[model samples]
Target: MVQVSESLFYKDVLLVFFEKEGYVYSNSSPTLLENIAKNLNNLSAPASAPKNFIVVHKKIIATSAFAVGGLVLTPIIVVGLIQAIGFGVGGIAAGSFAAWLMSLNGGATAAGSLVAILQSIGAAGLTAGATIGTGAAGATFMGTAGAKLFEEKSDSIMADLTERMDSNPKGQAQLDEFVKVYEEGNEDKNSEKGSTRVVFEIRDKLLTNNEAFKNFLETFVLAYNASKKLVNKKQQFKFFVDKTDKMDIAGKKLENLNVHLVKNYGAECVDKQAQSCTIMLNCSNL
Candidate 1:
């Protein structure tokens, strides 16, 4: 149930963000990866039945794992933040936990574009899930990811960018050129796969492209903080997130998300004394 708030439904919007900001390598694989793709896709798809009734999709998952409510690590998008954060806490990809519960009773749905958007973001994020309980199932994996993210953010490329945007503030020209490259790349119709390839170029220009990998640190941090919030007040979990319509998701919401990031553990992290976390997917897939 590890879900990222910004990534849940906005995967499509993130396509714009990732394309405009990140790079997309045409690293397409063989049909052999279809099972892995399926497993990833299942992580985002609408719940089709109860956790135990899921039939244990063995294409990618070899054992009879009790896949409960899952979320998209971001294959992303949807608009809600807090609620989706709840999913991150749960150790699933980002989408919906309450929705998963609804599926158990109403049967799973076939939301095509929704799944596709999620798949896109999912590619950037690590997919994981945990059982339904106030135990380590979700916390184990999420906490680890979060701690790592926090521990390394200082060196991550995005951290540098955020630092520039936050501290230097005068380097708007470089950041702007970075945007221009993305724009030109998107329009060139001949760029690699005609997709966004500006991430590397921008990183190269900034300092080192090789080090400028996608900053999924925030993703793990979201899972960590949300997980802590969820586990500490198990009964009040529902109140933590405010459910919103899938269509309501937008790129603009990321602003608040950025703020949320700083408040949680980014450089702007307010609680200086808080310890790093280690979280994980609670489920056991054999």
Candidate 2:
């Protein structure tokens, strides 16, 4: 009775784990923020309460990988074991049955030949089932990991886009224009990160109404990349455009590609009166 109770307890514990793991995958699917939330929740679970948050964080990372890996591998191992056991047992049973029949029919050699064929088929099936099942599991894990990683990369790009737009109204306007033109979602792709995207319609409007607005476009791209580089380096910075597309003020074809820099982009930081050019001399100038 005690042994049975202990077994039941472990089984219930596994079921709970399976439930939690399943929820993690379901809630986190197709979303990075949900994945983070699930991680945090898991970290704060009763099992994790005994450990420091940092340790919990590390465990969360490992658990994410292992949990997904187990999901991939468990079925495969089970199937392999089933196939091996079924075939091994069935082959022996068939061989014995064949010999018994042969003894009654006085055809022992013929029955032995039949037994050999059955054994060979059973061995082949077992080998094939195990190999295929293992391969499928590995592939499943690779696919899931690949999808999650791609989502992370895309989130990073969206984040940079949001930071760019928020830092510059004109840039944000241009982005809005692009979104409308491209028929893409205007909401910040990084929904969890409080990021926003520029609309394409707004960008087109600027192009049509403000022909010289091309400088804003060029400066926007340059500043965005610069800011991204800084962010990658783990630097805290803000971005602002000092100068805009004002050459000939109404010139076509962007004659002077110039940009000005604000020391550190913030509401409190005053814009410098002097302008520093980021890109003033296009090769067209010689």
Candidate 2 lDDT score at position 158: 38
Candidate 1 versus the native: TM-score? 0.18
- The whole-model lDDT of each prediction reads 0.28, 0.31
Model 1 residue 210 lDDT score:
23
TM-score of each: 0.18, 0.20
- How many steric clashes does model 2 contain? 14
Each model's number of backbone clashes?
41, 14
> In candidate 1, what are the lDDT values of residues 205-256, reduced to their tens digit?
2222322223322323333333333222211100011222321221223233
Error of 2 at 138 (Å): 0.9
Q: How many backbone clashes does candidate 1 have?
A: 41
Per-model RMSD to reference: 21.8, 24.3
